[model samples]
Target: MLMNPRVLVIIPAFNEASNIESTVRAVVDAGYDYIVINDGSKDSTLDICRLNGINVLDLSQNLGIGGAVQAGHKYARHYGYDIDVQVDGDGQHDPKFIPLLVDEIVNGADLAIGSRFLSSTDGFKSTYLRRVGIKWLSFWLQLFTGRSIKDPTSGFRASGCRAIKLFCENYPDDYPEPESIATSLKAGLTVSEVPVRMRERQGGVSSIGGFSSVYYMIKVSLAISIACLTKRS
Candidate 1:
């Protein structure tokens, strides 16, 4: 059992004004400390957080998802948090699974991912095209790392102290989810996946849409491949 663990939920938001409040509320109700990283949102995301008295880290410029999440990890490291869970501000990631991810960390996983494909949860799987991209990434990740990761692109994840520190020092700039998994594996960290239910985003469009999906797939694939070639620390 994890006794008195200092768990912190790091939410990375980018113009998610319509969804941030309810997402923060769910996290608050789940009884964990949280901080929202406002990644230079053009919308009222930062204002909403401030109005709700939510702890927030407002960046001066947009840093994409990777930079936003990295900032959160840096904060976790500075504050001495034992575990850091990445929950999206778009409400697609359910806060209820935060404990399960934390439990995996307590059980000795360096990183724990909330996977939608690990179970028969309805309405959790993303769109067909997105799933295709996810599957492609998953296959490459498993082939390179010798580990089965059903949902390599999942943003819902928890990291232990070691991972938090590593991520603070080095994290991808774009399409980070899959590349981060490869990095963890190359570093010899134990990664686990927990079955979790997800919901459609309450608001805001995905950053990767239409033609962006093709770009996203190619970019992530190259990132993962390059990460696999780098020497492990």
Candidate 2:
């Protein structure tokens, strides 16, 4: 493993004013350099970040999670960071496990995902329906990529230089968490997962909730399928 790789934490948020502050604070407390991409939050998320003196990139319009995260990757790349770690703004992902993800990257994993399912106990596993949806997606992803990832929908992940450059250039925009995994594997990147405990959202509503959960499953499944078929240049 390379010694002392420069790492940046990327927090993408949209309408997460209630939880963004605490989330950023946790990352800061963890002693990692971070940037918050305020994805045109209609809420006061940007204001909260500015008020707290957090490093932020304000988007003029909301571009969903995919766009926000891609913006972060671009920033990391421009700043010449060796690794980039993504932590959700809703506080579902814990910053303490960030080192584990980064360690996997340093050990040669192109993409290291923080998987709750990898742990047998103590984590917010989401709703049963959501878990079912995640499982279905996982099955398909494994079939296509020939890799088994327990939490393909996880947003808590770390990317090495290869994955960072791939995402910076071409990232999915709609319901991207699961689909991005397919993209990473298709590009011949090494994907691995580590066990991590996550808490329920501290505040604000999840972007995928209620009936949209169904849409999320279908949309992400389709995106993953398409990603498998697309030839990488």
Candidate 3:
């Protein structure tokens, strides 16, 4: 019944009051339909969204990234959106690359990840320690899924019809980006990485920083391994 694929940009915000408005505006200015999932921030994020007339879904409690993103996917699926793109609310993800990711999905990829390391562009590539962790995880992910994702932890990704449905049914919780990729590959979905230039967060603190980076590497690596093994069954 539809002539064109409907795209929904999902922005999961938690205590991103300082950056939510600008992030949402970028998506709006890019001319894509979007929904902001307010992940129970104790700040004025919800008020800002309301004041700016941004479309948002208010969660009763904090659901973390996975839960908030899943909520958006479920909404997209329910509304018959043909594509779902995730742009983080921390202002790290650039909206200009949305079309490129969507193009990959339209062509054939079920999941298209916007990879920061795939190209030789001068972009914000996180800290050195985090990059090391990402590469280590990437090696393990290739071992498990046979896919060489340059940026396994990239939250800037787009999912097509199949992936949107699959994720809505079984999405990972906690730190989910890498685990979600493993899950997709194990489920026989086509996953590809497209080069993208990301920026440093314009405002607010990152969830993973300092000593927490060590914890992130361990936890996400374990989660990816578990997702692959479980989905392999």
Candidate 4:
């Protein structure tokens, strides 16, 4: 159980059977109300959650990363959990930084992001093209939201009730990237970036690669452009 019971960490996982157990144990060690969103994983993901007796919200079909996370937000609202964090299921997000996030939330930020690119972090790569794309999106977010976001696409982040309510109502479905950052900022929630360590994936392969990378960049760029132009009402 968490020493600070109000803080929750929501891990959105899909087909991460090999990494889930260790991930859960580590986060529990860090002391958090850990909730896992099994996004219709085809493997024994749900079984693993059940066997471990962990809090889980299982979906009937794949809802992508955005849906999994937003579902967790909905859970927070329904259960009245005061604070929530997002960590990757592939074990890339380190649990060592959970304390820092908790402190940030306690200090008054609505969202605390673990940014790998905030400084020189070793053993991780975002590629040049991806970095360019990130900068492009960041510029747009800054323009629209008037806030500097270091890692807009970062999956490792913490959010309080302010962000949870916004995301529960409006989050992207697929290829959720910096656009979510824009949406969060538009909602008038406080957002900040904290330095955190990230490791390479322990298992499985990335879905965005080869020609898909180019397509993803183009699609996301267009989506971000569209998002920036419209002011959220």
Decide which is better by lDDT, 1 or 4: 1
Q: Which is the better candidate, 1 or 3, if ranked by TM-score?
A: 1
Enumerate clash totals for all models, in the order shown.
0, 0, 0, 0
TM-score of 1: 0.97
Poorly placed runs, candidate 3 (over 4 Å): 1-3, 231-233
Per-residue lDDT tens digits for candidate 3, residues 118-197, read 87999999988889888998998998878789999999999999999999999987888999998888888999999999
Model 2 TM-score relative to the real fold: 0.97
Candidate models: Cα lDDT each: 0.93, 0.92, 0.92, 0.81
**Per-residue alpha-carbon lDDT of model 2 for 124-171, expressed as tens digits?**
999888899889989989988888889999999999999999999999
Per-candidate RMSD, Å? 1.1, 1.0, 1.7, 2.7
Q: Is candidate 1 or candidate 4 better by TM-score?
A: 1
Tens-digit lDDT string for candidate 1 (43-71): 99999999989899999999999999999
Better of 3 and 4 by lDDT: 3
- Cα TM-score per model: 0.97, 0.97, 0.96, 0.90
